[model samples]
Target: MVFVFGVNFPEQRLASLERFYGVGPQLSERLMARFHIHPTAKIGALGGRQITDLNAELTKLTIENDLRRKIQDNIKRLRDMGSYRGRRHAMGLPVRGQKTRTQITTARRLNRVDRKG
Candidate 1:
């Protein structure tokens, strides 16, 4: 199955970018620390970078402005791995984790959370 999400928001895009690289929690935390963005920063809490240039996208709205290019590039890089990592990417599993059997999942759970609660 394909994971389809709207990345119209910069905060959402930043989050999606972290996952796009398949970077783990440690790396994500480190990157956030280095970049000076709060670990719990919401979109409104961010400035400058959180603004997506709709005008830019409207003008140069090719892959350069599209998330599809980034996703394709990562997938290509993984495919070039030719083994282990590539296989994990293909299977949608964490390429660096040991708890593969239990942790390898997509957004299925998020879509079907316990609404009764």
Candidate 2:
């Protein structure tokens, strides 16, 4: 299963049925009315070709230029916070939390076997 625009698209064979989860029964029927596959068609046996075509169509319908701008702005905001402290501030995490007695087991060690030798 794959999600696009919060709607789940099951694998190709089940693509039409998957629309039922995201769309109302009437809409689902209207959308897939053209496809006259047998109701007994096994979900796994449904052809993936239709699923791929639907995915392409959904991509074309949902993506917009304003969405592109919003994504670009978010990327710029992240990039502007250059340092770890700046990033922590942007993410609302503690910048100066007490580390006393905290586990250092996972801390990266600068000194390795070669350096020790």
Candidate 3:
């Protein structure tokens, strides 16, 4: 009776019939008993040894989330706020108003192009 509804006896597959979903524990056990299917019951506490790779998952989720673009937007917002740091960032100058006479040259460096050969 229960065998007709796919009780799954050993490795033998019965006829190709419509599948009946969600059999209760009692019903499943009963069906297993009737069909002579020995259920391999998993006993004892489960040892969770599977570790997820966060870098790969982060890259996958980060693309859809666009976190990199969000950071750039934040930087633009801070620059637009025109705070002391923002002003420095806007002018590409040191925030502490450090003298760039002979120390730093990157920001105040002049490209003296000598065209005389």
Off by over 4 Å in 3: 1-57, 60-71, 105-117
Tell me the TM-score of model 2: 0.30
Best by TM-score: 1
Candidate 1 residue runs with Cα over 4 Å from true position: 1-54, 57-65, 107-117
Q: Give the TM-scores of the predictions, in the order they appear.
A: 0.34, 0.30, 0.30
Better of 1 and 2 by TM-score: 1
Rank by lDDT (best first): 1, 2, 3
Which stretches of model 2 miss by more than 4 angstroms? 1-22, 57-117
The candidate with the higher TM-score, 1 or 3, is 1
- Lowest lDDT block of 10, candidate 1: 108-117
The true-versus-predicted C-alpha distance at residue 33 of model 2, in Å, is 2.1
**lDDT comparing candidate 1 with the true structure:** 0.45
Error of 2 at 96 (Å): 50
For candidate 2, give the lDDT of residue 28: 44
lDDT of 3: 0.39
lDDT of each: 0.45, 0.45, 0.39
Clashing pairs in 2: 13-46
